[model samples]
Target: MNSDCVFCSLLRDEGAADWIWRGQGASALLPLEDGRLAPGHTLVIADQHAVGVQDVSPAALTQVILLVQQVSVALRDAFGARGVNVLNASGPDSDQSVDHLHFHVVPRWAADGLDTWPGGRSGHRLGTQWPAELRRAVTARQL
Candidate 1:
């Protein structure tokens, strides 16, 4: 494990984390005191060193998604959560605290009272408008 990487340090026991489950190539756990959002809310992280989703392979991405699904189901069942939010911040612009690729499985209850980002347009709509053919081509390439 690299000492410079916080996730790696956590995996190596150099840093402390409230670990829940660990498999061969990943770990699922709650964050420490300063990082936790709510009780039983957790993060599912890739075991190998990956800076972002762009660095993860298709197989690894599949594994991570499956693990996140498992955690979501377990959290909902165990804690009676109304729902769960599976989120990931890919790059620095998206409020990424750590560089490592990880997914947050946060359990949401009616009483928790978290608010989502506002969904209103600004001066103009952002992003390029592509034809269906071009969109299909891009999706195919992503696969």
Candidate 2:
């Protein structure tokens, strides 16, 4: 394990986390601190120390997706959330903090009032501007 890597340390049981579930190559748990959002938000992380989606193997990717699905259902059932959003940030520009392949399964309630960031009059719908190649790649994954 990478001694200085926070995520690696977590995977090795060298650090503490509020673990909710663990499986062959992934885990899901609640964050210890509240962020810009509320508490009880969950983070689903790969057990292997991949830094980003690009570094995740196909098997790990599949497992992570499944874990996210499971966690989403559980969080909704346990917390009575109106919905949940699964998110990932890849690089520094995108605000990736831990440098580990992880997905945030944020439980959203009506009272949270978390407004999405506003984009200044971009000429495209929020996610519709994704390049065709990128869109095709995502669609092909059947994820």
In order, what lDDT does every prediction score?
0.81, 0.80
* Candidate 1 TM-score, C-alpha based: 0.82
For candidate 1, list the clashing residue pairs, or say none.
Answer: none
Q: Write the per-residue lDDT of candidate 2 for residues 77-103, one digit (tens) a residue.
A: 888887887889876666898888899
Candidate 1 versus truth, CA RMSD in Å, comes to: 2.7
Q: Considering summed lDDT, which 10 consecutive residues are worst modelled in model 2?
A: 117-126
Give the deviation of candidate 2 from the true structure as CA RMSD: 4.1
Report the C-alpha lDDT of model 1 over 1-143, residue by residue, as the tens digit: 55688888888877677788887677897877677677777999988878778788778787888888888888888989878877788887768888888998888899787754547745754456557767788789776
User: Any residue pairs clashing in model 2, and if so which?
Assistant: none
